[model samples]
Target: MPNLLRKSFNVVNRVRHTASVAGLSALRVAKGERPDAVMLRETFEQLGTTYIKIGQFIASTPSLFPRDYVIAFQGCLDQTTPLPYSYIEQVLKEELLTEGQSLEDLFSKIDKEPLASASIAQVHAATLPDGREVVLKVQKPDVEVIMQTDLGVLHGVTKLMEKLMPQMRFASISPIIDEIRIRMMAETDFIAEASNIRDFQQFLQMTGNTKVVAPEVVEELTTKRVLTMSRLHGISMVDEVAMRQYCDDPAQVMADTLNTWFASLMFCNSFHADLHAGNLMLLKDGRIGFIDFGIVGKLAPESWQACMGMMQALQDNDYVTMASCMVDMGMTHERDKVDQAQLAGDLAKMITRIMAEDKTYTSGKPFNSKEQADELNKMMLEIVEVGKRHGIHFPRDFALLTKQMLYFDRFMRTLAPDMDMFSDARVSLLGSDFKQ
Candidate 1:
């Protein structure tokens, strides 16, 4: 089996190349271990930062990864031992020097301990010289090289696997790896993230989204490897108790948050792409805090327009319009060749299969992660199969959108247990004038 570890090189990345080949061979499960997916999850956890980041991406991207892998990688947190404060200081000092300043010139104090630690970076609480509290996200040393080396090898293996297993050709593996590579590269560039923060804040204001807030970027104190922004006081939305303490109506809070995100998908230049529960929080001041704007998603105008119509069609269970919208969003080489009725039947069958698989034996209780992933993976596979059969090329941005919607579904399942996200009046999936 040519796993995601194919070639070796004579360059500096040789060690990573060797490890890729070695790591796959070492994945054989020992006695008492759960399963292959569990072993792979642990293997990624042990393989250092880039692999952990890869696992996180796998966990979040249901459209790309398999159900078991998705369920397994959910445990891949960015959490790690905090690198020394001096290392953090060193990065801050170096990045600031380019702007003719030092760490001390901007910050009054930086805490010795980090608020959180991840494979790529760690965040520390600090106070500006003007006494404003902020947090600095400093990237780990040699992260870009590690990511590059690992991703290069992985991409090769994916191409190899595509040739080895003809059945796997149903989904574009190389494109998925390329997508992940683009996202990882963007995340390492904090200068881009700072710009994203500024853009998101502006989008919030322009959309009259008073409840959701993105921290203001501090340009003087930010850099390509480090981000400095206002520190928000809040608790994660996953923290039910703390959320309840801050938000009187948690349901309304979630609704508002969803609406804001929904608006961004259509109106903003880019939407928050990686909104795992931890990235969003409920602030003490009764506002929603959106942190870490590293991985934002964007779509072409035609895609969003088709998406809006598709949502309305889905609401009405109008498979004909839904099929037409999907085909419109995708690349159709020949408009005359598209069989709208056939597409509609395929989509209707997919929906029916999904409805059959979605079983909540106990009312008001959602299925577990594995169950949900299984159902979702089945539906996604069906959709892809339909696309392949019809000679349609669905856009990657649409896949990203699907992943975000899945994340929101998990959110509503946890926070607003009984809330039907699409049908909920508060969530305008389309504009107010949108009709089925």
Candidate 2:
């Protein structure tokens, strides 16, 4: 009971601090003194890991955040002060000694410094006793406890925001918080991540695609809190200049990456939800290395079938079927007085405009001009606005799909300027029928 009270007090204090800072920041922006992205980045860094992870989440989900905030938070770095070596030793000793093995029994040597430190865990470089190089991802002590406290505070804040700003259509905060909680819990379990790695490896093998690589999980060396995996060396896929220097066909690399993701949606039961440049790499052997399978989305067999139906309907210009399929997928609310026909018409009109834009830009012109990108963003915003007016709430899974497509869009603009993503034979969401 005392512990619970302390945790509740901590949550309340944190929420108050966050509210104060946000209020001051809003006031500054209102006075025309907008906070610099660097300042915001620093603020998150000082605020600790949960906020840093939230910033990273905001950076990844552009559809859910304001443009300026998303762009600003993208610069938020995840560098954390390393826990002491004594703490690391203690954790390893506690977690590894149960099976009659000590830290030295498994690893020939463990580095005192970590390779990377984020919100929940830190990665350290190590070498197995069998002479294999590996990276050890160790979870922080009592991370779950801290996360629960922080998330509770976050929920409280979200409630306050909804009550204060009733005009803002901010979606249900509870569901969003629950989703975050679930994903974070999954991330905290190294065993689950190892399973994701193995599943992705099997997926790559089954697809007969040797161009993509998933890291090999070292099962013998893995535990619930600790994961050992093969270390990969490569340049980020987003580094166009570096990738160009390494590969003769960066365009093909981009295409293969997109196709790999598409195949995951069609074949694999689970797909990587986060595919930012940091998580994608152009390996030395020309294979695309996909890392960080912490956040993933799974479509049930029924859901996948429904998605395929919706895609086909969109391709064939069947507005009624598309709207019905969307409703089946729970994208809109079921109100007794809702006008299904009007909703279908609105959806169809919106799809027509989007398809017309693709038709007009079939040449696949370079997206170098800020004006062109801004126009595209404005079109997307307008679509979101229309959907909101119809009481249609886009699910997070849809947002994840759209986010991956946007990455493909940017990559295509840079690599294959002559290839239209919507009209190209290479990009097919509904398989061969939708191929250009």
Candidate 3:
């Protein structure tokens, strides 16, 4: 009865945003009027935060979702209506007062208007009593409760689907949903995010990538719901015009960005999973500023080994080693039943196809060329298809790493037109203890 009541409430809320009872035939009209991907994107936008977050998650995983859905959800921006300052102040006071400090006692001033607004939290520029500049990341009001309710709904649905069709169990929707829940819960807690920022900064220093920097997280002014961190001033990485002004060598700046991030995958305990343009910036000092440490990725020891092997093979253009690594990574079924030679040959053909489409291995903008982009996407999908045909399933982190590389690829096309990404001596991937 309790579950029924909750489901009723969620459906009612969705109905208010999704549709209404105009007439008996109105439901059919609504279905016809909107295509699945477009309708889903629109509904997510209308349903607000949790759905928007789910959409963002789908947008990030092109390998997991249908290509058209991924393309459509990319249009679903994070920009939303700002919460009132009164609520923001309330959250700040409640969080800081728990530490035996009032807002006035700690912060000299906090901008009533937000510095920036995102799907989950809105940031406010603030100054400490000691004149230290910082930004307060305040959680949206009752977001935890809303997320719990929505996730419960998703979980219940997945359970039902699995029960109805056992193949759904193989797809592992429940575990994936649980993973998303844990990550989303972590994002809500500013303290954990603060730790992530510091750790990445440490990783940067350890790797000697002085050009890449993460913000300094302030502990005293931080709580689970609210995070205060040193404000980083810089031009966003996407602003090519401003980037040229910040540094004479934009190409080198971009290399430093990729090198630091790549190094983190091997050296850091966790790599920044979310590298969307919003979180990366080029500081006034010409260093890369990595902000918002929410959504990080980690790999098991064996996974890292497989990743290293794959990276080495990619650089050497050793298709056979690449094929073996893919099998080791569990990108295929029944390892003893696999044909190594055929897999390697298929990979070679795909690479040849990409090379034929665009020769600008250095200067060619594959990202901008529709023919090149299609060729690349088709090549990647074909590899996945062949592996799946052989009963291969890739690890989730494999998809995450692939997506981040695609982002770096776009950055290369824009910032570093003439540089070799993997083969460059400056582009380091090995950790201190890594044998290779």
Q: Over the stretch 1-436, how does candidate 1's per-residue lDDT look in tens digits?
A: 3423432232356565558745664655333445577777777777777778778777766555666787788788777888999898888877776566676778889998998888788999999888999998999987777788778878989888889998777678888788888988988999999888888877776766778898888888788898888999998887666788887778888888887887787667798887878799899999999998887888776787787777678657799998888778755667568898999998888787667656732234444454564565556656655766787765666656766777777777668876766677777764342221
State model 1's lDDT.
Answer: 0.76
**Residue-wise C-alpha lDDT for candidate 2, range 200-293, written one tens digit per residue:** 8887777777888988888877888888888787888766788876699887787778777877877776888778767888988778899888
- Per-residue CA lDDT of candidate 3, range 113-139, in tens? 988888789999999899999999998
Residue-level lDDT for 385 in candidate 3: 60
RMSD of 2: 5.3
Show the lowest summed lDDT stretch of 10 residues, model 3: 16-25
TM for every model, in the order presented, reads 0.82, 0.76, 0.84
List lDDT for all candidates, in order: 0.76, 0.71, 0.75
What are the candidates' C-alpha RMSDs?
5.6, 5.3, 4.4
- Model 3 C-alpha RMSD vs. true structure (Å) is 4.4
- The true-versus-predicted C-alpha distance at residue 252 of model 3, in Å, is 0.8
Please give the lDDT score at residue 323 for candidate 2: 65
Clash pairs of candidate 1?
none
What is the alpha-carbon lDDT of model 2 when measured against the actual structure? 0.71
Off by over 4 Å in 1: 1-41, 59-75, 98-102, 156-173, 311-316, 331-336, 353-381, 431-436
